[model samples]
Target: MAGQRRILVIGATGTAGRQVVAQSLKAGAEVRAAARDPGTAGLPDGAEVVRVDLADPDGLRAPLDGVEAVFLLWPFATAEGMPAILDAVAARARRVVYLSSAAVRDHERRIERMIERSGLEWTFLRPHAFAANALRWAGRIRAEAVVREPYGAAAMPPLHERDLAAVAVRALTGDGHDGATYELTGPETLTQAEQATVIGEVIGRPVRWEEISPQAARRRMLDRGWPPEAVDGVLRAQAEMVTEPAAATPTVEEVTGAPARTFRAWVTDHADRFRAP
Candidate 1:
């Protein structure tokens, strides 16, 4: 941690990974943005752009060479190829800060076991619903002023991507974060309907929420080219959380020393995406 560290960021073009790259660069870490196609990753200035295909482990070795730390994002649904991937990273990197999900807490020991077996310094960030999830309703809000979805009353404490990235940067470059699992969430819990209403208020529109059946919602997602498995996962997760007590956490503030941005703030930042042409 004393000398200049080289950090590799996988999925560098993604919503969260982009922020990770930006924050890491701002922190003065020598950053490498890794993606399948380096040509279009659009990495921040001063960061080296490299091509690393996750599907082909042989090709990944070169890009990871001499890297001190890695920001691993599991784009695959299941951790099927994780063993080989973690082994590869552990071979070169001293630390790994993984972008994980809150669902991992339900089976905490299993995930921790896997990371521990990797024999590398590790930090797991288990974040709840993302503020960017609201972007899913952008098309509807732009057209009809009504966001239709199932489980309208299901509440989630949505953490902003920037907040998550800030924590990742700290864990990657700082000490005392190894082997830590941080559960990140927004400052407050709001239902899906309430989130839509907040977006409307931020955009200065009268956007309303229309509840639909889970089956219908699944069909709609499928029609829009979402895979069946993903559709099922979304509906099942929403239905299970509908009447359950929402889980809120202060991990963002604890890790970043700043309050997590509200959903309203996220809306204001991305209001242009929902603006009428």
Candidate 2:
């Protein structure tokens, strides 16, 4: 809240984390962007990039030093080492804003509880599916102009990383956001199939969505080195979304004082990722 408050951003190399680092710098906060490899984190010029492994909380002391606030993104699949990490964080930073998933799984809840008990002010951002997740289809779109996945009819309000980051920066620097859980989403809901079509429209191609069996998807994900439990969890969530479509939320606009960006806007912003090389 004062002149150039020091902000440390965990998971700075990730999709939403990258935006948070950039936006926090734009807000004139002195940002220390922490990642596993600070040398190649590629954060903005104003940030001070540092190496930190969340699994090894001892390395967090340097990054947390003189950091008034933190934007945390839990990169692990489990909450095994979170308590120690929070302990390190609480020793230095007064506030922490965690990027949580909208699904709100048990592991995430456990982490939240740990943050709550750490005696630090905190805000949890529970964003719906990220629009950037569609980048997983980039390879297929570039090669075949097709996205092959199950649950083509599963409608989800994909939240833009920028909007999520904007709300995050506010919580990191502003007041009255402590102990808040913001359910952030984009302006509209689109089925997976429709999202594919929108990408095609943005990039001037006919991108198609080919529905595959969930078993096939599960196999493919596991082969790609995803954890078996995470693969199964993703598949189960998608299957549930088919009948129970996710809707858009107004929290993004409420917090940032601007309408949440649309899925089309997100596609347009990152059109080159889907374009043929």
For candidate 2, which ten residues in a row score worst on lDDT? 1-10
Taking all chains together, the TM-score of candidate 2 against the true structure is 0.97
* Top of the candidates by TM-score: 2
Candidate 2 per-residue lDDT over residues 189-212, each given as its tens digit = 899999999999999999999999
| lDDT of the candidates, in the order given | 0.85, 0.91
> In candidate 1, what are the lDDT values of residues 3-34, reduced to their tens digit?
25789999889999999999998888999999
Query: Of the candidates shown, which would achieve the greatest lDDT relative to the real structure?
Result: 2
TM-score of model 1 relative to the true fold? 0.94
